[model samples]
Target: MLTFEIMLEVDENKSLEGNVELVPQLTLDCVIFGFHGSSLKVLLLKWKGTEYYSLPGGTVKQEESLDDAAIRVLKERTGLDKIFLRQFYTFGKVERYDRESIRKKLAHLVNPDLWYKRPISVGYYALVDFEEVFPNPDLLSESCGWWDLSDVPELLFDHNEILEKALHALRLELSFQPVGLNLLPEKFTMPDMMRMYEAILGKKIDPRNFQKKILKSGIVIKLDEVKKGVAHKSPFLYKFDANKYEEVLKEGGLFFI
Candidate 1:
């Protein structure tokens, strides 16, 4: 997205000649969700001279794949590379551009008349570890940081709608796959995995059923080690048995908890 951040970060003089070279009409918006062991958060970009916020987005280049464009944008905004991003939906509401708030914010980077022609935006979402990400805000943006999914501010355009749909799809995805396996560290306790699931699904999972389902999936293997330093009984540590996980995937590729 060519927000003030792009104008400021890439062009301090407010000129759009170079930025215009980017492909037109097609845009990519990415929703990067993170877990910090307690609260779940989404990465956001706050514009300069305005209180409004937006998901980190960019124009898809003529030569790059849509998937590569999302990866490029994510890396630019977060300094991350090679992270998995899944396309969840495409937004093409004619009335999506009817709002005046985002237009005013983009006035610094795009011509008022030209900016009003809203581009069809593709949506992609990825899960990440909050601690591993380093927030890197581009020029024209005041800050780049995590916003709690529950405490997100009034976002610009149809972004609020996009976030709602992404979260819905993810919750449904969790019912059949171990999507968060990559979000956690290599070794973790059952409680750690349980908490991550609860955060994504937005509900509490019973401890007994939670452990049973995960272990029964045969995707993860229980390690001999256990969590230490906690006051209660120690929880065992575990890791995904890559060989078995892949074998199960080849054998129909389904895991439910």
Candidate 2:
């Protein structure tokens, strides 16, 4: 039995290859959300030599803080050093520690004993600009890419439940958080923002009403520019006023969809 004190004394800054030490009985899973082509997407890693997929996740190093570990995992998978990330929940259900299932999927990649140790996982969600992410798989996975939220398949371990919880948390935040600042590009049309909201909220919004409410909040500013190179009439481009958005958030102003 590996004791907690023994696990904490292991070396830090080394790769996760062969008996690398990590904080005992604790891990994290990240649900990375992005928006593209009018669809909400989640980043997933395809296991090497298997058809199964899962969210990008990792264990906390002995010397690493939880936030630092999550940031490192996000950077590894998305190639983004910074983004909007938050801890929403902790999953420690006894049944979540499905050792046999983990063995079937990841035994060849990581220590077989790993699954038997840590059953608790900290759940985190991140919002990133879709176009900026260049997905990279970990050592155990062969491919990394996006899957539409509606199309995501059953994931390894309890990740599907984790993903569902993340989405639920995101929807709750949609009413007050400036989610678009991280998920959308610097410049986007009003419709693009609405689509992102609708996708996450799982419903449609009145375009005119959405425009009026969002503009009134002063979080977004209309530019003199319109989207270029489309056969149809181009929509005016809008950019988030980061300063004002933060100000409103500080003031507890509502962000209605």
Candidate 3:
């Protein structure tokens, strides 16, 4: 079974001549979110002729499982491997692709007969470090890059809806899971954690109250070190204690969240 970390970068326009043809009725969309130092961004690709941007997507190959296909699509775009993806939602509305603009785009890309088939998309999301990823869109796109979640460009084919749902799913995950663990560095400050959570949660958490609660959770350990070269007293650094985190994972799975 794929443990969700096997990433292999392939040419976005890799031909399907020798391999099995894709199952066109079903598609997978990857909503890759990256954390820049202080803000959250979503990866997007701009198609060759269209001004609209979209999630990295592709058809599921006949020989592969959904997870396998999503991973393949993930690799083709971001070139990252082994990152965990959360299958958040599925969009199967009959009118999903009926938009005139989408129809025009599809006409240029696929057969007229195939476009009539209701294309159901499985939405999956993964978190990656912004500095580590390089946008490598497929042949269909002229460019790809990161867009701040707050200022995402106009999208196509119900893509705006897909992105909204994906962001909602991410917010839900952050409520009970330490989703930030993968997005943030190994070492960081309490304020750093708060900013990420607030960005995802869309609200400011009480600083003093959150600090007391998080420190008491015992999952993060305070270190003796502090950031240097600052005029003010530097805040002490803290890191998630993996040993304690593992113990909790083994003992009924609890986190500071």
Best by TM-score: 2
Ranking of predictions according to TM-score:
2, 1, 3
| Per-residue C-alpha lDDT of model 3 across residues 1-257, encoded as one tens digit per residue | 11322222332223343456777678888899888656788889886656767888888776789999889888889888867688899999998876465657644443344355667999999887667788897866768899988899778778899989988888866644456567877777888777887777667788898788667667788888885665688888888886665555455443224
Q: Is candidate 1 or candidate 2 better by lDDT?
A: 2
Q: Give a tens-digit lDDT track for model 2, residues 46-158.
A: 97767899999988877789999999999999999988999989999888866677677666555445345545899999999999999999877788999999999999888
What would the TM-scores of all predictions be?
Answer: 0.85, 0.89, 0.83
Error of model 1, residue 32, in angstroms: 0.2
Top lDDT hit = 2
Worst lDDT run of 10 residues, candidate 3, spans 1-10
> How far in Å is the alpha carbon of 182 misplaced in model 1?
1.9
* Cα misplacement distance, residue 62 of candidate 3 (Å): 1.6
**Residue pairs in steric clash, candidate 3?**
5-82, 7-81
Off by over 4 Å in 1: 1-20, 103-111, 175-178, 247-257
